[model samples]
Target: MNGSGKDDKQRNRVIAKNEAERQTTGDIRVSAWTIVFAIIVGAIAVYIVWAWLHR
Candidate 1:
């Protein structure tokens, strides 16, 4: 038999890997601002409760 089938399979694998890598290169899967906003909201909640308990 010939080796074209094996070469085709290898090329397909390389193309798929490159595509997956490209998709994630510029993608912000997690936003830093979202995390910061959540932290700020949590701190505000804690401070409000602390002030209420002491006042």
Candidate 2:
């Protein structure tokens, strides 16, 4: 019984660790995309303003 309980605890810890890692990876991916999108938007805005002023 004790051995079985210990195994369950270990399994639960492993599952929790895996879940945390997955979440962190997802967060990093989302952050990277957000930064890329922000850059594209900023570039577009700058181009529009420059074109308007020059014209």
Candidate 3:
């Protein structure tokens, strides 16, 4: 019974680790896309301002 309990605990730990790693990867991907979007928006805003000033 003790050996079975140990195996269960080890299995649970491995599952938890995999889940955490998956979440971390997802978060990084989202962060990268967010940065790209922000950069595009900023570029558009700058161009608009420049055109207005020139006109």
What are the RMSD figures for all models against the true structure? 3.9, 1.1, 1.0
lDDT of candidate 2 at residue 50, scale 0 to 100:
100
- Candidate 2 segments whose C-alpha is farther than 4 A from its true place: none
Give the residue spans of candidate 1 off by over 4 A: 1-30
lDDT of 2 by residue, 1-55 (tens): 6999999999999999999999999999999999999999999999999999999
What TM-score goes with each of the models? 0.48, 0.93, 0.92
Which 10-residue span in candidate 3 carries the lowest summed lDDT? Answer: 1-10
Could you tell which candidate, 1 or 2, scores higher by TM-score? 2
lDDT of 3 by residue, 14-38 (tens): 9999999999999999999999999
Please identify which of the two predictions, 1 or 3, would achieve the higher lDDT against the true structure: 3
The models' CA-based lDDT, in order, is 0.86, 0.99, 0.99
lDDT of 2 at 45: 100
Most accurate candidate by TM-score: 2
Candidate 1 lDDT by residue in tens digits, 1-55: 4699999999999999999987776364456667888999999999999999999
